[model samples]
Target: KQKLVPRRRVLSRSADLAEDYRITSDNVLHLVLKLSDLNLITVRTTCGQEIEFLVDRYRNVISLKHHIFQEGKGFPSQRA
Candidate 1:
């Protein structure tokens, strides 16, 4: 066991480097939400009737409109 204690770890980048210093000890839950998770939001559409949609965040209203068109609730998507 003593012989192995002085040997360099295979996974380590260098022998001089000890424990992993770059990575923090903070818990994952403590960090801000993921980009994908942040995008998961609810959207309400009222074309004629009320409709709720769980969609990712869009850069603009046109993108949301495009998404609605793709859903095929009423009008068919021209672009597909």
Candidate 2:
């Protein structure tokens, strides 16, 4: 039997654009943010720059990382 890998659904604009990375207002990711355990995820770059994102409890760490990546924000290599 061949190995099977799950493919993540890619978000697009107007159901046509596939690989657009620009974060526009209409293409912004709308994650569920008002769950029981809402948390603010803050990412700090090497140069002391910080960015914040709101995520709920149900999302896994990988999903958070994926979100950051999907939004074209770029993830930090080292954790602080």
Candidate 3:
């Protein structure tokens, strides 16, 4: 009988496996993981106020516009 091991466990123990598969790089491993959580976007208002917000990369532009509107900022209205 053969025993089976989970790929996750094997990859965790072996750096070579990860490197060969290009799962991560030495410098960017943490950064790549962090990018999944949020992306930073800087918005400059007409009043010269610079605002920074963290947004999900998967969100659509319409949703982002609504978010900015809720923050009391103006965004160009979308036409259907």
Candidate 4:
């Protein structure tokens, strides 16, 4: 009789590993994964114009605000 062992699956892409498992103490990997998964956010301007933006999920409020300001014309006075 022969004993058999299960083969571990290999992840071809870094993104796959990042998404599937919790990598301990890997801030760079986490950041990379977060940046890769983009979320679409819709914002209504004070002038009543609706705009959509594709942004990273892990972006902080300040970073988001800066992005909105640079790409979306102007930054809102209130928190987004």
**Clash count of each predicted structure:** 0, 0, 0, 0
lDDT scores for all predictions? 0.44, 0.57, 0.57, 0.57
Q: State the lDDT of candidate 3 residue by residue for 1-80, as single tens digits.
A: 22213333333443355545455334333211234557888877766666677899988899778777777435443444
Give stretches of model 2 more than 4 Å off.
Answer: 1-35, 71-80
Give me candidate 1's TM-score against the actual structure. Answer: 0.27
For model 3, what is the C-alpha lDDT against the true structure?
0.57
lDDT of 4 by residue, 1-80 (tens): 22211223334454464446444454333121323477888877776777778878878788778876776666455555
Candidate 4: residue pairs that collide: none
Q: Report residue 72 deviation for candidate 4 (angstroms).
A: 4.1
Model 1 misplaced stretches (Cα beyond 4 Å): 1-47, 72-80
For candidate 1, write residues 1-80 as lDDT tens digits: 01112223333244533344333344121222335522544454443444455555646777767766666467433453
lDDT of 2 by residue, 1-80 (tens): 12211133334334544334444455545433333577788876665667777898788989888866765455555655
Better of 3 and 4 by TM-score: 3
**C-alpha TM-score for every candidate:** 0.27, 0.39, 0.45, 0.42
Q: RMSD, model 2, all Cα superposed? A: 16.6
